[model samples]
Target: MIWSSASAGPTNTLLPAGGCTLLPRATMYAPRMLAAVAQESQQRCRFCTRARAPRSQSAGWREVRRSISSNASPAWHHTRSISTSHLPRAPLAPAEIAPSKRVIFSGIQPTGVPQLGNYLGALQNWVKLQDSQRAQDEMYLSIVGLHALTVPQKAAQLRQEKWDMLAAILAIGIHPDKTVVFFQEDMPQHLELAWILACCTSMGKLNRMTTWKGKLAALQSASESGEATITSSEASSLNLGLFSYPVLQAADILLYKATHVPVGEDQVQHLELARDLAETFNRHHATGQRYFAPPAHLITPTKRVLSLRDATQKMSKSSTDINSRILLTDEPEAIRKKLKGAVTDSERRISFDPEARRGVSNLLRICAALDESRDAHGWAELVNERGGGSGMLKSVTGDVVLAKLEGVQKEIKRIKGDKAYLEKVARDGAARARERAERTMREVREMVGF
Candidate 1:
C-alpha cells in the first residue's frame, strides 16, 4: 500500500493487519500530572511538549502525553527554492508490502517539497508502514484536492498546485503500483460519505474542534496589535474551510474503514471524533459485527519538529516570516542558510534543551528524526544518548538532516517535469479510490435510508 501525505482525504485498499501501537487508556484519559507528562515528553515529546518539558527526562509511550506548537512547511515560494526534479532519490516502493489481511489508509497535502517537520512528523513514518508487509492491508496515497478548498482559490492556480504536489509524492517513493494514488475531488464517494457521516455528527462535536480556535488565534496574532475586536464573523469566515472540515475527514477514514490512522500528536482529537462516529454509526445500524473498528492511531516515532526561527511556535506556511521554515523543495543553499541563520541561545554550547533553547534544538530534532541510528530517532534519545555531556550533536545533526533530505529534493525535481505521467497516475488513482469508496458509501446511504 502507498500513502502520499494530504490532509483532505485519500483512497481505499484492504491492508493486512500491520503492527499498530496504541496509547494506554490511562495515557489518554488521565493526561495530566507533571510527572506523567514529563515521563511521556522524555520519550517522543513532539514540538508542543518540549515547551513544557520536565527537569527529569523519561522515554517510550508513557512519554507521549504532550501537545505542540504543531507544524507543516510545504507551501513553497516562487523562487528557485528546492525543486523536486533535481535531488537524490528515495525508493518508489516501501521497503515491504502488506499481506492480505487488513486495510490501512493515510494522506497528506502535496503543497511542495515536504519540510523536515512534515517528513519527521508524518511522511517518514509512512515509509515504515509500507515496508511492514502485513496481511489484510492495502495502502492508498491520496492527493486531497477537495479538502484544500476550505478557502477561496484561483481555479487555474490550485489545479497546478495539486499537480505539483502529486509529483512530489511519487518521487518520494510512494509506490504507484502498491498504493492507490489519486485526487480526492475526482471521486464523488468522499463527499457522499462525508455527507452521510455529517448526518450522524453532532454540532457540539464540531464545536469541540481545536482547529477553529487555533486558526482564529493565528489570525488574531497576525493582525495589527490594535486590530479592533475579534468578531465571530471574522472567525466564522475562516472557519468554513479548515474548521467545519473535520466531518469530511472522519468520512475520509471511515469511507475506507481504515483500521489504523497514522497522525501527528496534534491530530489525535480529530481521530477520536472519527472513532466516536464509527461506534455511533455501528450502533445505529445494528450490524452483527461492528461496521467500523474504532481505529487505532500511531504518531511518528520522532519528536515533532518545530519552527527554525521560534521554538514556541510550530513550523507552518502561515507564518508571516518566510525564514521560519525550511521548505522541502528549497535548494541546499537555502536550507544551509536557514540552518546557519537559525535562532539559537546566546551560549555557544549546543545541548538538547528545547525549553531554554528552542531554535537549535528544533534543528536537532529534524536531524534526529532522519537519522539512521535508533538513538537519534526519538526526542528522549536526545537526553538518553548524550543528555548529560554534549557531543557533536549540532554539527552531527546538521549532517544527518542534509543526508536525509537530499533524496527527496532530487525526486521532486524529476517528477515536476513528468506532469503528464503524474496526471495519469492521479486519474488512475481516482478510479481506484472511487470504486472502493462507492462500496462503503452504498452501505452508509442504505443505513440512513438514502
Candidate 2:
C-alpha cells in the first residue's frame, strides 16, 4: 500500500501493485496523497481486499485495469496502464534478509609482561568473547607498539616486550584461528589513517583527555626525584605523540569500521572520541552516504585490581615497588611471598569493605575472580570461618591464583621457545589485516578525492 516516487514526471507516483496514480506536483511528497489514494482504492476495488498481503503475480495487468475501471469513480479512470514487467522489484520479506556479522576490535600496549590487573580486567574477557561469539563474528587484537613509543624506550627492550606480549596473548587462551592477533606497527595504513583523522580532530578536545595529564604529572615527578627542576622551556618541549595519542586510537577503530570495541573503564574517553570523529567524517566528508558507523562501547567486567603497595592507585607496571603487582610469569614461590606481604588493615578479621579495607578487599576480589563459585563477600565469610585472619585469607587467595596461572605460565614458556611459530602467526595475521585495510583505504581515497 506504500507509494514510492517513480522515474516518471512529478505528477506520477508508482504503487506496489504495478500502476501509476496521477497527482498534483505539490502533493507528490505528501502523506495525505497516499492516504487519499489508499482510501479510494479500498472502497472501489476488490483486488486490494487484503491490503497487507503480497500482490499475486497471477493477476494480469489487463484484469486489474478492468476491475478498477468498472468500480472506480470518474477520477480513477485517469489512471495510466503500465506493464507489470516495467514495475520495480518488490521489497524482500523480513525473514529473507540476512543478519549482519559483528566486527570487533581491541588493542593493548606492548610495555611488559601482563600483570594480574591486565589479565582480569581485559584479557580474560577477550577469551570469553572469543569462545562465546558467533562463528561469523570478526575479531582483531593488536599489540600497539606505536602507543608505547609515546614514552622513552630502549630498542632491544621494546623488541623483546612485543614478543612477550604476543606470547602472553596466546598463553591466555585466545586462539589464533578465532582471532586475528597482530602488531599495530606492521600496518602502515594505521599511521596513514591516523594522519587523516588527526587533521579533523580538535586540539581542545584532545586537551580534555586525562591520560596525557597523568603522563605529564609522572614526568614532572620523575624529573624532581632526580634533583632536576623542569623549566617552562623544558615542559613546552613535551612530545606531540603523547598529547595526540587518542587521534591514532580513533583511526584504529574507524579504519576497521568496528561495530564494537572492548575497553576498560579508564579508556572509555578515548573510545568516545573515536565515535565523535566517525560522526564528523560521515556528516561532512561522506558524499550523501554514511561510510563509517560509530563504534559502540563493550565495557569489560569491573575487575579493577588495585596496587598492593598503594591501594588508592591501580596496579601498574611503572610502579617502582615490584611487590605492588604480580606478573603473569611469576614463579609459585614469588607469587606466595608477594601475596603474604600484601598491605592490609590492622583488623584481624577478613572483610570486603573496599573503601575502608582496600588492601584486604583487593585480595578478596582476586580470590573471587580466580574462583567464580564465590564472590568477594562469600570469600570473606569463608576466610573468617577458618578462624586464621589475614594470614589465612592470603594463603587461600594464593592457592587459587597459583592453580589458575600454572597452565598459562607453562604455555607461555613453551610458546616463547619456538620463535618460528610466532613469526608465522604474525605474518598470517598481518596478511589478513592488510587485505581488509586496503579495501577500506581504496574507498576512502576516492571519497576524499585523493
Best by lDDT: 2
Clashing pairs in 2: none
Q: Scored by Cα lDDT, where does model 2 land?
A: 0.73
lDDT of 1 at 424: 84
Model 2, span 92-165: residue lDDT tens: 11112122677778899986679998898888988987887788888888888898887678999999999998
Question: What is the C-alpha lDDT profile of model 1 across 1-450, one tens digit per residue?
Answer: 112211111111111132112232222222223233333242322322323223253121223333433594322111111111122222111112122354567777646456566666666666677766454567876767777767656788777777876776676677777778888778778887777677778888887888767776777885667667667656556755566577777778888877667766566677767766766666556341256655556433655777777778878766788778877787777777676657665554455666766765776666656764644335435534554223334445556667877888788888888778887888788888888888887777777777
lDDT of 1: 0.60
Give the winner by TM-score.
2
Query: What are the Cα lDDT values of the candidates?
Result: 0.60, 0.73
- Ten residues in sequence with the least summed lDDT for candidate 1: 5-14
TM-score of candidate 2 to 2 decimals: 0.76
